[model samples]
Target: MNRDKVTEDRKKLGDFGEEMAKKYLINKGYTICHEKFRCPRGEIDLIAKNQDDLVFIEVKTRRSLRFGEPFESVDIRKQKKMIKLAQYYMNYYKISQVNVRFDVVSVLLDESWDVKEIKLIENAFY
Candidate 1:
């Protein structure tokens, strides 16, 4: 495939993973607050509320793990970016007086585009 096609396919895969992640969260009792929330700082894949706590979710999806684990891509720099995004999101919405946690959803897809593995890591970061 060409470079543009490759990039487009990656974006489509990400969207698919995010959709699956949202459903997974809803299945686990979380109310989806936002999807692909973005600002000058960065983009947050999903923002959700569960009980009294606000959850910031970062989704990493992979068709295969030839490079590394799906979640392994959230390096220190990426973590910092997500923190900024979460903070911005909370401040923008004036969300306070509640606990906040960072969660990660790693999704792996099989050859047929079916979900292979979905791992939810609560409090993956601060």
Candidate 2:
């Protein structure tokens, strides 16, 4: 495929993965606070709350694990950026008393955009 097509495909896959992650979280009794939360630093794919805990979720979607596991794509720099964004979000919302956690949701999408695997990692980072 051409570059544009590849980019489009990736974006579609990512969207599908995010939708699956949202559903999964909801089923696990999480309240969806936001989707695609963004700031000058970066974006957090999903923000949710379970009771008093605020969750910052990073969704990584992959067609295949030929390169590596989907969560492996989140590098240290990316983690730092996500943390900063989470802090900004918390402060902006004036959520002072809630516990905070970073999570990783890895979705493997099939050609038809069906989720083949969904892995949820909680407390993934400090």
Candidate 3:
């Protein structure tokens, strides 16, 4: 495939993965608050209400795990950015005294781009 096609396909895969992640969370009783929440600080994949707590999620998806598990990609730098974004989100919404948490939803896909696995890591980071 050409570079442009590759990029487009990759984006499509990401969109599909995000949609799947949102549906999975909803099925688990989470109320979707935002998808692709972005600002100058950073981008949040998904933000939702998991019962009483506000949940900030990072959804990572891969068709192959030759590098490592999908969640393993959320390195320290990314975590820090996400943290900052989460704080910004809270402040922007004037959310106070509400429990908040970070989560990682790893999505594994097959060669055909069909979801093969979905793993939710709750309380993934402080």
| Weakest 10 consecutive residues of candidate 3 by summed lDDT | 9-18
List where candidate 1 sits over 4 angstroms from the true fold.
Answer: none
> lDDT of each prediction vs. the true structure?
0.93, 0.89, 0.93
User: lDDT per residue, candidate 2, 1-126, as tens digits?
Assistant: 899999998887888889999999999999998999888877899999987798999999988879888999988988999989988998888878779999999998776677789999998888
Using all chains and alpha carbons, the TM-scores for the candidates as numbered come to 0.96, 0.92, 0.94
Backbone clash pairs for candidate 2 read: none
lDDT of 1 by residue, 16-100 (tens): 9999999999999999999999899879999999888899999999989998889999999999999888889888999888899
Candidate 3's TM-score: 0.94
Indicate the TM-score of model 2.
0.92
In Å, residue 103's CA in model 2 sits off its true spot by: 0.5
Off-target runs (Cα >4 Å) in candidate 2 are: none
